[model samples]
Target chain A: MHKSLRSTLWILIATLGATAISIIAISRGESINALWFIIAALCVYSIAYRFYAAWIAATVLAVDSTRATPAERFDNGRDFVPTHKWIVFGHHFAAIAGPGPLVGPTLAAQFGYLPGTLWILFGAVLGGCVQDMVTLFLSTRRDAKSLGQMARDELGAIGGTAALIATFSIMIILIAVLGLVVVNAMKHSPWATFTVSATIPIAMLVGIYMRYLRPGQVLEASALGVVLLLMSVVGGRYIDEHDNLRLLFDHEGLTLAWSIMAYGFAAAILPVWLLLAPRDYLSTYMKIGTITLLAVAIILLQPNIKMPAITQFIDGSGPIFGGKLFPFVFITIACGAISGFHSLIASGTTPKLLSNERDICMIGYGGMLLESFVAIMAMIAATVLEPGVYFAINSSAGAVGSNALDAVTKISAWGYPVTVEQMENLAKQMGETTLFARTGGAPSLAVGMASIFGKAFGDGLLAIWYHFAIMFEAIFILTTLDAGTRVGRFMLQDMLGNIWPKMGETSWTPSVILTSSIVVAGWGYFLYIGVIDPNGGVNILWPLFGIANQMLAAIALCVATGILVKSNKLKHAWITAAPLTWLAIITTTAAWQKIASPDIKIGFFSAATDLADKLASGTLPAAKAAIAPQLIFNLQLDAWLTLTFVILLWIIILDMLRVCWRCVTGKPILPLTESAYKPSSLLDDWVRD
Target chain B: MIIKLKTLWKIIRQLSGDDAYEVYLKNFAKHHCNHNNTDCSTPLSKADFFKRWQDEKWQGIKRCC
Candidate 1:
């Protein structure tokens, strides 16, 4: 009774606090303290993790503590070694946390804080966390199957094929959008470009150090890499100050785009240990350290969120991306909320390392909850910037003319007023010539982070803090870019092998170069188009990436729901089914709008038609007319891609439903595929104790 | 003081994957010591094992968004 009382009191306090905080956060207000977002996220995560996640782990999945995991059964010293639960959690978190959580929330803040914050908090607890934990548990039970293989086995051929196509397309768009972000961040900024450029040689140096001097010393090498990386962040300022040095590093968007493509290609085909491995190691350390510092700094600073609780952009006239708040916020902020990408990592990547089935809830659900908090922090970071500055940095010359004065006038007319002098002052303070029309979320987020960090640590070193944040984000984006390119190469090879078997040979140099080029070309085309886009490439690429990501999540949920039905747990399938239903509704809605809406700004097909008509009638503006034909083609291509995503999404969902219906009707369906249980020895030790 | 510091240092090594080879050998010995027979397959060398590990880790969808 005493324990029950304590528990009840705990629930009551958290519930009341969560309700009170959310109400204040959402109610019509301006300049709400950013601290409210932090409190609200914490309250929601703790409650959901404790109750909903625990119930799913205990009742729905029936995770048996005594059941031996695959790691215990197949203790290969390489992949399947049993690990401490906390260590597994950390590794899992590191693998899943990327620029997605950081960049998505930063972009979604264009709609203001309320929508993104609520979505991140509620979406993760109910949708993303459940999806991840259930997928991890089910995959562990099935011998750590890949997402594609699980779909093939449980949901049949159509579902499996859809999953494969979704993953490949997601990779392409994800890499391209990330490349666009990097290009936008580094373009014309010598400090960021130089710091980012320095990372390659720095990583290689550490790789050689680890390989030759102290074999297998990852910690030592990464420490050396981190120290060197920090120095470059400082070194960038020196380069920026020197005119000749600055000219060498500074480049346009198109040049940076090509350079990034070259870097991605090289990283893909080059030996992994040299660049990819060492960079991954070094970046993971920096990711953890920098994210922790940002968290502490946010708490210490208690900065006010300058953006309103809801913006006029909610109706879909925002310069960042063109979409309504309802589904667009959900679509834009998939990673922190219900990212489909986590399902890929959750299934085969970390499941095999678990020693106990019970650890799935913590490692999967808890890890995502932490990522959601990071998303909340990002939203706070972006929102803390003056709304006028946010728009100035995220807008494109296409929306707000090419010059700073014209851009200021256009943005000021939007009710979020700014001046040319204010923009110039900010740029000068941050050690840049101009922050206008930066477009991608990276530069703005860096400005926000630098502001918070400068106030919290030392107000004197704003430029260094700003560059550090940029380097931190660049490291993440570039890491994802190369790793994704390599993975895409393998997938393409795996498919191409069906036509010509020799193309699948990974070690064959000809096959390697051929497949790598194909994958690079796939994203490089999109990246190049994005750079030339006057309205800012982010407006085009980010939504498409978001849709692709959510579609992948939809595929993952379909697989999870199908497995649950096969397991004869169709009644409790709502845990996966609800989120699956939400994703299906959201992605299809967003895709439909993108493809069919008459508004040229919101609809891909409409935009293409408008541009084609303009070109035909000779009414196109001078700058636009030059790029008119290509723009029309790209718009149509994007429309077709959106249509394809929707079609694939429905196919998978319908197949899952069909299998589910067959199960409910007592028809013959695939039997549940859990591995035979082996009682763990750890249970015996507990009994002895 | 030294013991605490040593424990922390070991953890850093483990987390950064620096101690993978040592951990692999220890686990292998624990799994095989009871057999005392040649049927126990020889474990991979440190260099070969690291190579195998990198190939697998870098392949597939290793990282997320």
Candidate 2:
């Protein structure tokens, strides 16, 4: 039997075995034993990674083994990063894997542990891993072209232009939604807010020391930064206890939004040698170390997965952001399981660092599989909480019933009942006024983790455990925030430079500041609205983010399909084309549903109409009426975003058709100019020996 | 029709290698069509023309060719 065929069969058996066991356990009303399930999952994943992943890495990927990495051939101290294959793999994995895997899966567990887990596992193997690997391979072959450029090259000029537009728009929406999640988590927690807020100065101090005093001492600087960051977390407890300090840090949501904007501007304007580089380095370390520790902790603790498989909230009315399990779970767990944004990174940054083509499997496919496991851990963390507490923490007051008393009543009416007394007791235990409407998945997951860690470490360490969880999430989220801001700033400057050449230069301080402010304000506006939203921003912003991210994936896949067809690998094109078609269908249907549905809670168009009706009937209160215009505008914006995605997808499809026609008829297609860098003869062996 | 499809597929596979397939297609088109006009003598070129073809007010032949 062929080795590839045999290995593929084993992977199927393992995956099916895991799936069958999980289904039977859930159906039989047996408690999900975390240790057993995790072991089983890891065993299966390891086999897949070792046998199947390696085979694909060697053959299907067909990496040119003879070529020497850039580090060996064109080693530059700066951007031309040269490192060992394993080190590069580690760095890439650490950079991409963040709190996304942890937070998304935990929240999506509202559907059922089985559904969320299966999606993470299956989605990673088929959709996410394939997207990442193929994008990396394509980009590497094209001299590390970006996702947008690849789309244009394979699809044609029109597809490429549309992809760029989609990318820019998606970046804005992603930053805004993520910013909202952070603000909501920190809103009422002065200790968390202060500690996280302190990281800025800590990063700057480390940044200065690295730049001026100890240049090239990344390891040393990061070590100092991590220690200081932990100290700041400890220090936050004292600040929270102090009345004056607490008052100073405890600003309202809108005020916090402004502060974040100011921080983004400052961070962007500073030289990379300063805060940005040091913070990125420290964040890189913290993200990797903390996620590993949490995973280990979960494995060692082996806590029971207590939450029911399916919640009563499956009717698009569940608390922590509305929408049923079928679509929303797929959307909520977007980045961790499969994200279009990763395609951007795969093409933009990682591909540029590829030393060997074979490494693509490890960095792309293996990295995504690791992220999926993180999501699985997040699911475990979320499900461990008592159902009543989970409901109280995740449910918005408006949706859970309306008002506290009503919320309690309605929740008690459900199978997993919670009394007012029970709610108060749980809130007191968790040290919060009302756990209701803490829409950000981070806080609830933190609280649950704290309980687990508290039990393991000792009762007295609960506070430390809580802050540790906060610091872990903050490190990842802040990394994303700053990195996103810098990327956005650069993009804006590039666009502006096209109009006024001087504005494009990175060294121009005035232009840098102007572009930075514009970029910050773009995402900041959305963050501000999300913060002020009484209905919990997750309800509105998450779906938008999900759709946008998915659309980017569709674009990426379209580009890949076009390239395959152009290369006359039509038989194999379906490997990418199939996923592309499915994503298009999913995104289009979701967008259409979002636009057409009359429910103000689900559909943007219907929501707009509902608001207008309320205004005309004079039934809305003055305060509600004031916010009505904003809601209506938001609805229209949603529609516009949907339209943009549709147009981008179609443009790419048209480009693919053109490319296919060209190839089929043996027409001359213009190829881009070649790069100067040459691959070693060793690397050429696999491709052309 | 089947033969044509098979021939087209073969041409596509050959084109995947290099631009030599373009010359072959051009010759094949000239033999079949019996036209001296460069624009009409080649199916491959016709395909390129149509792919790049735009229906707009500012369309320019120089910009394309």
Candidate 3:
């Protein structure tokens, strides 16, 4: 086909798919098929990748293929080694993806699928991908500087400090919310608890094998690790079947939360090779394989979307979490759409290994497009289950009541009718004692995945598939939990190093222990409170994580825009500035509501005040009265933190505006400091190998 | 036919990280010491090079959310 004709064909396909999707979503009083959502997403991504991404690469970044990259100019066989583009893409994608994309969309399914799906598709292409690519390009030109270093160099000291503080704060909240998810998924479920616990030993065994038995044999070690992991997944079923063994592994949410906290602390203090590295390698492979399998299964099965286009939850009466759809949906679905975390990875590792500057288009922008697709798949998975079941699984006991009958009655009154026996049967089939209030989004997603896989693969394997999905999600979440804690410790040491010079040394024993303890406690306190909260921890922790993450993204975009202005690329400044302005609005509104709204359910301060009023009036029940003070304190603390995030965002935004003003007024702020231009002499194509 | 199958196997091994040391040795010989040898065989032993690479790769802020 001719080139223009090919473009025309693609445009036609995209238009058709979009039209079909909007019609399905908007049509009232009828159920829609999941296949339309998948088709719509795939078509839109194809068009976006081919056209919008191409335009950005050519016009905005002006990628020059002949220019020598830092990886080529400073090829030292260590950090600056030039790598194959696909390998770099894989590594970058693995680093950025976590349980965030999967869980966020699952939770946001409360407003149905239309709003979340649309935001994910538009957000990644316009906001997330642009931030990542521009940041990667800017950092690469400066010899692969990290985000914080770039902020300090391009903006000023204040911007740099705010960026560093945002990174540290986001890391703590990210870990806490992730830990809560794992805790909720494992609570009182012997099958999931046993399977997840088995991964630690499997990783340690693989680590020792790689270190002592067969050094550098990563493939062999990870292969063995994967096989053993599968065996453990199967073995967990038998363990759950055995009455005595099940009793040994079964525990409540609070106990599991404590165990996870201890695990995070120990994993941080221990050597990387022992548990963190090995587990990371295993999970990377599993992550890719599982996501690929899910995409395939969804396409093959084409399950119908049971949830409506819009639900009553859009009004902010959502049982899963509070806040209306406008800003909350964008906040809820961060990772899949435009996660700020990817900016760190883009500026951190991907730029260092870029053999050719052109590969930036693929690694930075394309990698995020794939993550958005994962979020779309998560939406599909959440909506595939009966709406009643999704609500029953995701809503907390406090919202829907504790028992199965009460849950059924409450959910039915809300419009979606489900029977107690039906819930029990589904739980028994999935090999769980009860799935009434799983609360964390993991179990509901697993149920969705299991149904899709079971329908596509075979019958009587729902339990196996369900356990496998749980293990898959748990592996990645645990990987993030341990890795985030370690990063947090390093950042803490760097901060404390200013006061006590000796504390900066990473290898010092007391410094390591002290920093690790502080880092663990920072997130651990939130995880403990979340586990004890009657409404489920995700309702509190997830929004905090989203706000913190978007704040970091705002900082990253500010740095990008500042760099562009300094470099005299004023014409293309809108590429970064537009997203930065929109994110500032969304995050500011969400933070303001969280801090000062009068609604107890949505606002942190209001919730605290309401609880206090109840206690003072002696209207609280005896059981609730005991923990009311703590809950109030937590709410108040969360309100303050939200305010802090908003303040940091404004500080960085103002710093960026200062740089822009200096550029516009010709005040000669500072000259651009890109690395000396070097021409590539290598005759070999990095990709041809 | 057999050669094609063997080539496929080699590519799979390379992608799955089985041939990392060999690739590293080639790159090291070509770029690290300024030899620019086409064959790119390095003086450092395979085990030593692999150990060094692992240590440097695992160091700071490697994962994200």
Candidate 4:
């Protein structure tokens, strides 16, 4: 076909597809099929990746095919050797993706699928992919320097320090909320508990096999690991049936929370090669395989979405988590739309492995596009459940009384009618005793995934499929927990080393254990409080995680925009500045509301005051009054943290603006810190030999 | 079709690090020598190269959420 004709064909298809999506999104009076969402997201992604991404690559970043990347120029056989672009794409995708994209969208489905779905589709095109690509480009030019170094070199010390603090804060909250999700998922469910616990031994076995038995045979070890992992999922079913085994594995939320904390601490102190690395290998393959299966199942099953496009919960009265649709949805769906975390991965390892500068578009923008698709799948999975069931699973016992009957009545009052019998029956079918108050997004997402898998594969295997999905989600979450704790420990050591240099020696046994304990304790406290909170811990921790994640993203954009302005590309600075400005507005509003809103459900201060008032008036029951003081304290602590985040966000934004001012005023601005240009003999089309 | 399948297999192997030693050797041959000299120094053995590669790849903030 002629080039123009091919272009015309793509344009036509994109237009038709987008139009179809808009129609589906707006036609909320009638139920829409899940397949419509799949088609719409896929079409929109194709158009955005092909057209918008191409324009940005050519016009904004001017990604040159001829430019030799750091990998090619540095050419160290270990870290910087040139490799295939697809390999870098896969590696980057695996690193940047985790439970965030999967869980965030599932959580945001509370306001109905429309809000989260639209944001994810358009947000990735305009915000997420742009951040990843621009950061990748900037880091590649600067010899694959980390985000912190780039922030300092470009935006000066204030921005650098702010970015560093934000990264550490985000890591703590990220791990805490993730741990909370795992605890909630496993709480009082023998099958889930057994399956998740089985992964640790399986990972250890794989670790030993790779280390002592086969040594560097990753594929072989991973193959064995995957088989054992599947067996564990099956073994969980048997354990669930065995009276003694069920008693051993089944535990309430608090006990499970402590167990997770202990596991994280142990995982952090252990050698990476023994536990973390092997689990990572198995999880990567699992992640890829599961995501693939989900995409295929969504297409094949094409189930109708039971939830409406717009729900009344958009008015800040959502039972899942509170906040109006504006900032809450954006923050809740961070990883799918635009995660600040990806900027870290973009600058950390992906830039170091880029074989050619041109591959940045595919590896950066394209990788995020794929992750966003995963988020879309999660959204589909969540919305496919009846709205009554979704709310019953996600809402806490505190919100809708403790009994299943109370949950049904409350949910039905909101217009989506469900019954206790229906809930019990579904739970039985899925091989669980109860699914009420799963609270975290993981179990509901697993329910969603299992539905698709069971419907597509075999109906009789719903229980197995559900456990399998739970295992997949839990594996990734645990991977993040272990890795996040290690990273947080290192960051703490770096800070503590300022006071005591000996503490920073990563190899020192005392230093390792001390820092690991402190880091685990920091997040473990939040996890403990969350586990004990009457209104599920997700409500308190997830928003904090979202806000902190977005704050880091805002800092990343600041660094990117600063680099652009310093290079005299002032006109092109809007590419990064646009997202930065929106993030600044949204994060500030979310933080302010979280701290000051009068609604007890939404605001930390108000909740604290309300609890105290209730206690003083002697209106609360003894059980509630006993926990009121601690609840008030937790709320007050959250308010202070929100204020701190707000302050950190402004500090970096003001620093970035100051740099922009200098550039505009013709004052001597900081010089660009990119490496000196060197000509290369490598062809742009060079492939791995 | 068989040829295409073989090519696909090779590509997958190359990307997934199944062929890491082979790729590293090729990279070494391509870039090791300075001043246009060929084979100026022998590259590390495959076992040594693989160990170093694995270590470098896993260090320092490799996972994200």
Question: What DockQ does candidate 4 score?
Answer: 0.42
List DockQ for all candidates: 0.53, 0.01, 0.44, 0.42
Instruction: Sort the predicted structures by DockQ, highest score first.
Output: 1, 3, 4, 2
For candidate 4, the TM-score is 0.97
Score each candidate by Cα lDDT.
0.88, 0.69, 0.88, 0.88
**How much does each candidate deviate from the true structure in C-alpha RMSD?**
2.3, 14.2, 2.3, 2.2
The parts of candidate 3 lying over 4 Å away from their true place are: B1-16, B31-44
Candidate 1: tens digits of C-alpha lDDT, residues A357-472: 88898999999999999998899899999999999999989888899888888888988889999989888888888899998899999999999999999988998989999999
In model 2, the Cα lDDT at residue A254 comes to 78
Judge candidate 1 at residue A597 and give its lDDT: 87
Poorly placed runs, candidate 1 (over 4 Å)? A684-689, B1-7, B33-45
Weakest ten-residue segment in model 4 chain A by summed lDDT: A680-689
Write one digit per residue (lDDT tens) for candidate 4, span A362-440. 9989999999999999999998999999999999999898988989999999999899998998899889989999988
Query: Using Cα atoms with residue i matched to residue i, what is each candidate's TM-score against the true structure?
Result: 0.97, 0.85, 0.97, 0.97
User: What class would a CAPRI assessor give candidate 1's docking?
Assistant: medium
Q: Give a tens-digit lDDT track for model 3, residues A1-689.
A: 99999988987988887786787668676777777877787787778888888898898778888888888877766567677777788878888888889999999999988899899988998999888888888888889989998888878789989989999999999999988988888989999999999999999999898777887788889999999999999999999999899998999888998899899999999988898989999999899999999999988888888888789999999999999997999999999988888888988688877888888888888889889889999999999889999999999998999888988999999999899998899999999988988988999999999999999998689999999999999999999999899989989999999999999999899999999999999999999889888999799999999999999999999999888878778898899999999999999999999998898889998899889999999998898899889899999999999999999999999988988998899886756768887887653764436
Residue runs of model 4 more than 4 Å from their true location after superposition: A684-689, B29-50
Q: After superposition, how far is residue A644 of candidate 3 from its true place, in Å?
A: 0.4
